[model samples]
Target: MRSLTGFRITAQRSGVAIAGTAAALLLLTSCAGSGEPAQEAGAAVAEDCTPLHEFTTIEPGVLTVAAMNAAPKFHALSDSGPFTGIDATLIPEFAAENCLEVKFKPMTGAAAQLDLREGKSDMFGGLILKTPERAEVFAQTEGSILYETLGITSAKDAAYDTVDSLQGKRVGTLSGSYYVEPLKAAYGANNVEEYQSDANAFEDLKAGRIDAVAWQSIQGFNFTDRDDDYVTKILDDDQKYPELTVLLENNWPHTKGNSAMTAAIDDYYERAKADGTVARVLEENEIGEEAAELYVNGR
Candidate 1:
């Protein structure tokens, strides 16, 4: 992998059945680039990163992050190789701030968990929600990013208003997405259709093959509001659904009890929020600020 801007990445992408996509592919991880070690959490920007580096890491001076593919905004492979979206892009800066180098190991969420458990990954994030089960295994941070699940249907169709309303309807989302199992438990597995990509799911919804599309709120905004025919329904604050808080917010989860790592990440988040880094990064990535900010910054 080449370092386009002081960061390099490696991805492990599961094959997708998109048009012209390979039926199967395996990825080899790689890394590049070097920089001055960054300062520690809450330390002055110019402070040395030695104290922060004193703590143990999966690889000395190298922060290997585990991430999953959630393209256009999370993870993607380019000519330069694998890299992260807004948050991922911040890794280099995060690394620099902590006096470390950033490398990535891509995998499915399940695989990421395994990697974390076995010590292959020093940390993990990118649309990763903080769940009770995960909380048991990792040092999950409080909301690093916020979102509520949103539902979509063809412009030709009407929005679904309640969980009961979806009882018998056909719903679609990315296969194995966090939304699937819970939706299945509530709507019945038979009624939930999982696809390899959100693009495919939305296509099916548009083709009338599925009744509605369940997605992260920002994703829903991207798929529906962008099109004249499609409309969206945002669940009210009081409602509990697949997109309830626990499942919607992203957390910076690293090794359990690794307060140094936690403080480092949280400090990055706070700076990102204060300096408008998070907001600017979101817009630069073409994500709608209003939709994404609904849950960010306590708005």
Candidate 2:
């Protein structure tokens, strides 16, 4: 709900996992007993961080994060007891920079959001789209990545160029997603099939159970990056369906009223963008350049 324009943030990173491996578990436990603030990047001494300590988290010197079980390139709970994907990497870096130990809790759907609202968790780790409805309930950080919804269809079929064009066609989307209702409104409710996961939606599309799949552009690319049978493209925006047409931004969600945490995380992103860390992380995860370059223009 707050704005973070022109903020400055700088923090140090101890050698940690970039590839989402067992090293993340080491990063989490290695600093648990230190109880001291993490040093700034390349600093000779730690800055006075009494203010950071003044703000309360679910636990002292620990940031408990609520994470979804699986979301492909965004986040997944690895068997190694560490999270894998973009948010997984970024969140640990944020914790390390802020001199806090990190703890992850597996949750999904409304329960995940409720965890943040009730102070059961300090933040949500997966990529959360920035929207007014969410902002009204949570203290969302600045735009970290650009998000665009794409329409996926078989290569042999014509693409749905606009939202309304899917009116009579069967379209599948992730259940509980922000686009679900708008998609159902465009493609008649009876024509829309909601799946619990993207894998299920795409499988139904491939088997002709649905005519198309509406999903995140990045995640869709992960599905169709090498397959020639499917193709993905952004659907043109229609005034009647602005939620589907307008470009969206993604950010980390924290409990509302935690202004200090919001400012700290925002500062972290601003510095990460300026130093090329953000783009580097996106690239490592195979996200497109469009998203890597989006932090320059805030929504």
Candidate 3:
């Protein structure tokens, strides 16, 4: 099997289908020196756009982004329309704050980090978890949002909120997620099923192939909202299962060693929070107030 890191995919545009394999062609978009916000094809650029902070980007006045195509809750990459979702809007706001326009290149989660390391993109977007390993490789800003891993089960089944409840139960999770192994260890390896995507896991869960799907709380909310007879429960953190139970902070990953860029992003975060921009954005996306608090200060 080819490593996911080796596969290259292009940004989705009107009349384009997103590739799901390594056979996808790589297409790099060129930025104009216009210094205005980058938009989908045919979107007019304004006459004036000034940076609120002084920071360098990959291209002059363009914030090249390696966006996660799969994560619609945080940022949705559309085929023929403007970007939407929390990070989608937040990233543009940050770009404008730095006096740059956005130029997005949609790809998988792993590809985003690879692009950052190769200097192909200024930053990557999604509900990116903050980790020591990632921080060592990229300059990360303050927490843009909170991520609380939860257990999502069918309403027909008993709600699960404790580790004991999950023992021996068939639980599904994303293949490469941070909580995957921890969940397997806690619930027993034989009892855990890893799917390539959350959508697949949700499919299995609804079909009774699995007892529950363990993923971020936001996903659970989205699933239950779309599918009746489904419910979510916050798992209790017994300290031993903190990775699965703790509220984690998600942030943006920029090119490594870019202190000015990092500082500017951090500044943007502070200003966004203080002025209620972050709260307003989260609420507009239907994110819960508790999750919003995590963005303020993870509990």
Q: How do the residues 155-236 of candidate 3 rate in per-residue lDDT, one tens digit apiece?
A: 5356666767667789997655666777887888888898755566777887889988877666555566555477666655
Candidate 2 clash pair list: none
**Regarding lDDT, does 2 or 3 come out ahead?**
3
User: How would you encode candidate 1's per-residue C-alpha lDDT over 16-57 as one tens digit per residue?
Assistant: 322211111112122211222222233322333443323568
lDDT of 3: 0.61
TM-score of each: 0.71, 0.75, 0.77
Clashes of 2: 0
Model 2: per-residue Cα lDDT over 30-91, one tens digit each: 22111222322332212343333235688777777776433433444442454556666677
Candidate 3 C-alpha error for residue 151, in Å = 4.6
Q: Model 1 TM-score?
A: 0.71
Against the reference, the lDDT scores of all candidates come to 0.56, 0.59, 0.61
Off by over 4 Å in 2: 1-26, 29-54, 69-72, 77-82, 107-111, 142-156, 294-299
Give the lowest summed-lDDT range of ten residues in model 2.
1-10
Ranking of all predicted structures according to lDDT, beginning with the best and ending with the worst? 3, 2, 1
Note each model's CA RMSD in angstroms: 9.1, 8.6, 8.3
